[model samples]
Target: MSMSDLFVFGPLAEAATFEAVTVRPLDGVPARLPGYALTGAPDADPSLVVREGAVVEGLLVSPLPEAARARLDAYGVALGHETFKAQVDCEGGAPRMAEIGAPKAGASGPDWDVAEWRDGQGARWALMAGEIADHAPPLSPTSFARQKAMIAARASSRLRAAATPAPATLRHEARAGDVALRLDAPLSGEFFKLATMRLSHRRFDGGRAEALPREVLVGVDATLVLPYDPRRDRVLLVEQFRSGPARRGSTNPWSLEPVAGIVDAGETPEQAGLREAREEAGLQLDALIPIFEGYPSPGSSTDHFHCFLALADLPREESWRGGLDEEHEDLRLHAVPFDRAMSLAQTGEIDVIPMLAMMYWLAHHRARLRAEAGSDAA
Candidate 1:
């Protein structure tokens, strides 16, 4: 089989990402796509649009192997892009027909800047490219498309974990090569994934342990907000059905809990918290008070929670329907006095542990918050 050529713009033109997608680092010559301009946000994939006098400069990678081409095709298909042959002006060579991935419909935007993209999003894209490489072989483009969100979330999780500071003052400090891991086949789902891994880690006694198999439910980082109206001495809680309790064979699976949502691929926890508060309860928070950031079930899942106390105005509405229709959420919002909420927590009526924890935190800070509210009124 004869190898072909690919004219790539955007992050795909970069060496690291190109190598990850293609499974090897191959040299490329500079090329230009005439009568076309690149468009999209700085943080998004650049799309090609028709422009009479514009020329899009990019890399022309030749000798694209079969596997590499297949992977590239899968990537483009997953992104809702289509490949078409285009005549590209190659440096020191005549114009040649090269495959280019473009948006189905012509899109328009500012001139493409590879250097600017490198400065802003290169590292994260590189990490995500590696993830794509790992999945491109086993999964079809359609299947990969369905799991793209979770894959991006996993990559974001990796980037965050890498950048976060882990203090080992009380625990054993991990040395180089303290742990080694190899991922197995993952069970992919629409919003989450179950992954199994074989890992070996150094024991507390400083000896390396044998590799053991472990499975974990991989979930995106999320934010949870418990809305409190300090002046009114009340808090808003949302009641909704939860699958975990239902799967656990509980007779009643409807849970009274905080407003929550998953942190998107590029969004911050605070942003997600505010967005969720609006979507789940239609409340614009006056302020967001950080309560805790911890794992809900660290041993068996990657479900990290960023919990917050949202100070908001709670009217006399006893009950109201809320939640985004797009998400298929049928939530009931309840405005309960702080005392009643705490009592529910104490009596185990509020079975959601994280919400209960937040209630306790509110209890500790209630006096100060109310005093502040009183002071502001004066």
Candidate 2:
């Protein structure tokens, strides 16, 4: 069915979420429905529950697809036990209606608009609903409500993509000396968006030198990397399926890597790295040595993957499974000898690039790390 046939009055009425519906002037539309009143300006109006005597009014739109319908059902509209039926107008027009729990007795409000409701807590809920629609189908209002709350809590501090600014005009110039590559950058007056991927063309001597259109350049503050020493002889490596690699049709879907996490705002990279080690692998780090501070892909993504070589004491018999319970992480720790770990990296069995780099770093510093561990034990 056409999107125009759907009419959303409450949380779903926001223009950002409901692009099909517009606020442009329309003529001869019906104005009243039982128990509701239209409040505020015509352009950004809201429907409020006035009184028992008042009536709510809205236009009839199109039927929603099964997917959208399921998402809305999961939104838990408080209309009680009313059977799902077609809402027929006096002129013989009808729309599908799923009766939900009715408003509380004597419930009334001076201001109630879908846009405002969405702006507060409803926007997050709606975005989650959309995600659920995309991932899990046949959404139930109860499940949507639960997932909405969970995702909102996890992403509260992170800026939304919509709120961030887009990249502006870019400038490019060639670097001097032996390197002939051009350095492409945003012009002085331009602004870059946070946590977004960007691509730009580089020009040298007023001529186009290179075109970089596929790189994802996002701006990030810091990164955290976790290193595990497996029971002294080996180190723990986590193997998990990554969607990013799978998207590229990699032969190996599972990656062997250390426990890592993003450094939150105002948090030190070392603190975050150690915290992630504890949370992901249940390792209490002895010392965190900074290996390097650099970007993961300087040509593409904005993530600055901070590398850390964390020293930890390993017990041979201890096999406590660990991972953050909230994040649904499935982690398996392998305690293998240092030599075998290096061999895996050489053969490409450990395919993750970051882990390979860390393993190589460990190879050179293994003796020093072991001596430090022995001193700590004494």
Candidate 3:
């Protein structure tokens, strides 16, 4: 197959993101696409639209390798874009025929800015593009599009993992080449991905260990909020059917737990916590106090929890229902006294680990919180 040029005016125009999608090095020259205007918004890819007398300033990457072209094609298809032949005017040269990916329906939005996107969503997009390339040969582009949401969430998870600081004071400072990944492949599912990997890591004794096979249940970061009414001395708990317990063949699959939801691709953990507080229980939190931030089960899954104690007003109410209809959540909200919640945890009634952890956290800080409730209102 002959290599073709690609005219990029969007996030792909950024050197780092473009490099991630291509296997071979390709030089890009300044180019202009006449009669097409670029438009986009935050958290969305740039789009091209036909506009008379308009010129889109972009980069013309020449001789994109066949494999790289396939990768880009999968990416474009997943984003609802179609590849088309176009005439690109290279700097100081006559117009040349090139391939461009544009929205199938000619979607357009507000003005697009590459610099603004590069500073924010670019890192996650690049990571997502790499994963798209990895799974495209076995998984069709149509199938890949169906899984793009979860893929973006997973990419956001990776981006967070990279930026998070891991203090090495009590642990060994990880160095470059300490862990070498030999193999990584998808194992299952669309909503929640499962993957198997073989990797080798540095041993405690300063020796390199042989690669070991491991299966991981890939999951997005989530927020767990235990809403506490400081003035009323009560906490709000949500009761809902849990699939994990059902899968384990438990007699009672319904669980009593704190409000919880996934940290979306573009949202911060705190933002997710507040949103979940309202979504799961219809409560406007006064304040959110951090309780925990770590993996629930690091050995087997990528489920990290950002637990918090949400201070809110809980008027005395019998069990009431809440939760988003779209999520199929039939949640029953209970306003129980803080002491009673602790008793439930002790009696094995509050079986959810995150809820129990948050209850204990609230117990430890209860006195101070109540004492300051009058002044600490948000």
How high is each candidate's TM-score? Answer: 0.85, 0.46, 0.90
Top candidate (TM-score): 3
Error of 3 at 153 (Å): 2.7
Off by over 4 Å in 3: 23-26, 92-94, 105-108, 137-148, 374-378
Full-model lDDT for every candidate: 0.81, 0.51, 0.81
lDDT of 3 by residue, 158-216 (tens): 88888999999989999998988643663477688777889799999989887688888
Better of 1 and 2 by TM-score: 1
Residue lDDT tens for model 1, 179-263? 9987776344556777778889999886888768989887878899999888888899899999999999999899999999888
Candidates sorted by lDDT, descending order? 3, 1, 2
lDDT of 1: 0.81
Model 3's alpha-carbon lDDT is 0.81
lDDT of 2 by residue, 242-361 (tens): 887999999888887877776653356777777788788777776688887655676555455678876665656244466777988877766666777788898889987778888888
